[model samples]
Target: MWIWFHKLGSPPHFYRTAGRLVPWFGIPALLLLVAGTVGGLAIAPPDYQQGDGFRIIYVHVPSAYISMFGYVAMAVAAAVGLIWRMKVAFAFAAACAPVGAAFTFLALATGSIWGKPMWGVWWDWDGRMTSVLVLFFLYVGVMALRSAFDDASKGDRAAALLAIVGVVNIPIIKFSVDWWNTLHQPATIAKLSAPSITMDMLVWLLAMVVGYTLFFAAVVTMRLRGEVLLRERGARWIRELNAHA
Candidate 1:
């Protein structure tokens, strides 16, 4: 396990491996996304309460879930980089920031759209909503901090420390609904018992969640490959790679 981990830390190995693995995750993510979208929007029966407006949950819920997942991933990668001084881990953490931010933005936007109809407001200062917004800023802050320094190593360390610190917000975002009275609905899928949703809706929702997770993997791998090339530009293997390309 340690040998394989070290091998993966090598830029050339990771680059070649990521190129080979992209299709495996990317193809399934696309298929599952299509299946989930169709199943949620067209096949699943309407919510007894919100009707078709609730259809947006297919996109909103997955986006929100992924946003939090991305932050956790970023924090873990940052921690790995900081503790082990692994260049690959730093590259991966840097790659996660933008993707996580995009997902967070999507979540907020979709949530607002969903809220406009359900809550009769386009925006609110509710705990969950506010916490998620703060999460978005945290992603931005990490990215900004990383780019702030003239020295790349200093920037990476700064960003990594911030990522580790900012992880506290993730749980707050997750439990905000439960901890406080808020406009946002409590979790339907993430529960100790069976989810409150029906099997039909549940199936598609779960698929979307899986699809989003896979998509994140695909995107991160692609980005990590590029990051490896940039970081390894001075190495001979990169010259060979460029020649091969």
Candidate 2:
């Protein structure tokens, strides 16, 4: 098992395995996204208070969920790269930043759209929104730190350190609504008690979350292969790959 695990971490092996796995993750992600979005938007009953406007959760919730999930995954990968000097982990960490940042942007934009109708304002300085905005910056900062250096090793080290340090914000963002008076609502599905949402809503929302996670995996794996190629351009395996092409 350990031998296989170690082999799996090798760049060539990982690249090949990831290529084979992308379609598995990508296909399911697409189907789930379509199904979840349609169910959430067309089938779920409107909230008595928010009415049809609540349907945006199909996009907003998944984006927001995956935005945070991506950062945590990045931080873990960065930590592994730093501790074990794993090149693949570093590549995975680097790939996660832009994807996470994009999701964070989607979350913020969709949130603002929802807020305009609900809060009578498009933007607010509330704790949840503010912390999430900070989360977005942290993703951007990690990516910027990586590219700012001429030496790839130095950049990876710096980016890894930043990613590890930025983990503090995750908790802050998660609990911001509970810890502070904020217009943003608290957890619906993740609560210690029974979920606030009805089962009908819960089903599709969970599907969206799963779909988002698979989408992240597929996209990050694709990005990871590219990053690995860049880092390993001079390696024999990469040379052979190019030769075969």
User: What's the TM-score of every candidate structure?
Assistant: 0.98, 0.98
Put down candidate 2 lDDT per residue, 10-97, tens digits, no spaces. 9999999989999999999999999998899888899889999999888899999999999999999999999999999999999999
* Backbone collisions counted per model: 0, 0
List the candidate 1 regions with Cα displacement exceeding 4 Å: none
**What TM-score should be assigned to candidate 2?**
0.98
By summed lDDT, the worst window of 10 consecutive residues in model 1 runs over 225-234
Can you write out model 1's per-residue Cα lDDT over 1-245, one digit (the tens) per residue?
99999999988988899999989999999999999999999999999999998899999999999999999999999999999999999999999999999999999999999889899999999999999999999999999999999888789899999999999999899899899999888888797887898998889998999999999999998998887776777899988887898
Worst 10 residues of 2 by lDDT: 183-192
lDDT of each: 0.93, 0.93
